[model samples]
Target: MVTTSIPTTTKSWTVLGTDGFDSLKFSKDTPLPAVSDYEVLVKFHAASLNYRDLIIPKGQYPFAQKPGIVPGSDGAGEVVAVGNKVTLFKPGAKVVTLFNQGHLGGSLNPQTSATGLGGVIDGTLRQYGTFNENGLVDMPASLNWQEASTLSCAALTAWNALYGLNKLQPGQTVLTQGTGGVSIFAAQFAIAAGATVISTTSSAEKGELLKKLGVDHVINYNETPDWGAKAKELTPKGEGVDHIVEVGGPTTMEQSLNAIKIDGTITIIGFLGGVQGEKQPGFLDALVRMCTVRGVLVGNRVQFEEMNRAIEANKIKPVVDPKVFSLEDAKSAYQYMWDRKHFGKLTIKIE
Candidate 1:
């Protein structure tokens, strides 16, 4: 790999405090960190927003750093420089770093040192950021910078949960809750895997759109509050769904149990439906019935590469309803996502 000198300073957006945190403050004169032997510097072009980014400002994510940290985890860009030991990618390659900085090769462990970009470390919300080269994956030839940016967190997590852990198969029934980034990707990936997909949406319009995407069934949770019964009704013998990509924590856990098949797998990854709530009924029984519940953080570099390979082979397109906001419109973008007004992935173009 080729190496280059890190500039003395770089432009970035830094959070100041948690109190009434609104917009990302720009700092054009911020100094860039010198690249280490295992790291590389990337010139970020685009970054996508996830629900976690919204909760970070509210102090809901305990693992995140203090208020004054950059708050983004999904991004894609060109590698401008590399460290001495970097061998996977060279400078000038289009690449995206894995969201979980420490969990490369699908190993789940805390960082040995302080090296997480964006939250625990300076993130890619700035014009440039440094990351260990092991965290970077080559962007698929079919994807643009914006599309590639959406993969790091949401898409990869869904891919790992459904395909990696669950091994979702063709003709199996799969359930996805809500229309957030991970849920949306779960819906698309299940359909691409030839599984019959059932998705839930609060809005009728979004339900219609999901139906058009070859979704076998869509439960309008707002219309039918007891949507789990409806999910059972849609499947054979009312036997319940084979796999559930669960994002709703306590709010929908009971219903998810009711909607799942005997020995089904439930992958819990987000709390978009509601964060903290009382334990749902039948949760233990659901496990007793041989149902599996697994919590998924975002995936690692190996899974990211596998997901990209699937995307390339299947020509799967991400459902991106990006609200084009300038870097200055970062606050507005966050607010839009906070209000849950966007239909698909939310994004900000760094220019």
Candidate 2:
């Protein structure tokens, strides 16, 4: 009789049910997945959070959640083993996981939506994981594990918003609402593209931080309720911003429409201001201004690679929050992100 060896196991965090943050629980004996012919085994080093990660467990995301699914979308790690057919990555390679495993290029479709990590399948929160070689990209040489982890979702979404569709041009003006991870990345990417950046934040201190980051103008939304009009006035000749990274949904859409130039673009990436409440700008609003409004998901692997190239070329750094957490304290990390107190990306280290 032949005997087969059992695969090793490791610790991981998962969403037990549709119960929100409290559903995030840890398991010390989760099975370590094995590499298939086109797969690679990775030893996770760090993982980061996105707003999507916060609502996924609560059944608030657009997609249906799988039972007992691991709950993380952004992660960086080192390859520990590779399947015989895996040529793109070998053991010891530093890589970042792709947000969507099936969407390598082209456009988003049902297949692409199904590939979303932490949404329809197991994700990156585990200490060890096996992924298809095509589902991962090399981490930027200039970034550390944590910094690289930040790119998988938030940074990539911001990159997709600016470069995915119409390609933001230099000398144009971009308005970013709030100082969240995506907003900061949009500002940084817009600046790198030689565009003028006008940022809005709730407090005076965050506005100062945006200034230090080289934003051309900072509007305190708390002080200026009509910040959208103010943003338009701040643009050259009051022509309005050429692009608006619209993270706030119904609450800020009308203002975004007001701030944008005729024929401008608005990338809807998040709903930090809550998904419900006031009615949002409909198609008529966009048509009236001849504007293009796009829903920005995290980019494909091709876009991810391009974003990394730009990161290395421009020496762009991710704005991560000062406080760090271990894998055991992941719940508290999510809570912090929920509180909206962190200015930038919040991360967890896997030990």
Candidate 3:
């Protein structure tokens, strides 16, 4: 059913080649794709940028990059139209794009890994996009479009890190590093679950801001290079934290290792601290610490839906960067994320 008058062309951005942010070309007349049976046509009102939005063009991502692909994995929109076979969503249903369309539940194997958006296939940079009904989940009714846009990637990853394996308990302690999308989401989720949170940042201003988010303690990593031990000491009886959301790869792992409680879990989500080092950190350190070290891909549809429900139940608002960008000025948004000036999720208004 088509609930609204559909346009023949939709404005969008395309990654023409692997030249970084400059490669994003705006197309005023980007042809609107046809909605197939079992597909829904989403008129995206807002989209969020992730690190891959910057990396895909330079061709650094582990997965395949479609030339001239629409470069965004996180999008929030309405179902303007749906094919007859599309049962999960109807016209006018609010939806958010799933990072991995193929992986619904269970373990993510190689076949499921191939369907990551904005890289392996065309993604949500366009105003209108045709996605398989399974590629999206219901948006949390409590959130606005821009807030919902941050869910598909960072939020899910954070949820998966905390709740996927050990399942965060009420009294457990969580240590989150930095104030990026994933870190902030982790902190929020931990706080909502009634866990104590200790977060790290570069400056006192950001540290205070983190404290405002209900973090039990905020450590300035620049001021305390031994922040790991300090964070560990803040836990119960000078013991380490129960869960460490390790977004920093090689560079920050030493501190992460120093901070994890014996038999605790460290979920490595990104390499934000740079991968290159004289000697890269390895699993041996985690082994010596006697803790579980795990790596998290974004998450599956089931996790996405679960996280959305939690977000709504907790009244958790996404920490969007104060500076919003228009769809046309997306390149600047990418630059802003790269500069690390934004405190949380970087978003673009796409309507």
Lowest lDDT block of 10, candidate 2: 1-10
lDDT of 3 by residue, 163-209 (tens): 89999999999999999999999999999999999999999999988
The TM-score of candidate 1 is 0.93
| Candidate 2 off by > 4 Å | 1-7
TM-score of 2: 0.97
What TM-score, computed on C-alpha atoms, does each candidate reach? 0.93, 0.97, 0.97
Model 1 C-alpha lDDT per residue in residues 45-143, reported as the tens digit of each score: 888888877777766665647557776888889888887888877888999867767777645666622344566866667778888887788998898
For candidate 2, lDDT tens digit of each residue in 171-238? Answer: 99999999999999999999999999999998889989999999999999888988999999999999
Model 1 root-mean-square deviation = 2.2
Candidate number with greatest lDDT: 3
Q: Is candidate 2 or candidate 3 better by lDDT?
A: 3
Q: Which one wins on TM-score?
A: 3
Error of 2 at 314 (Å): 0.5
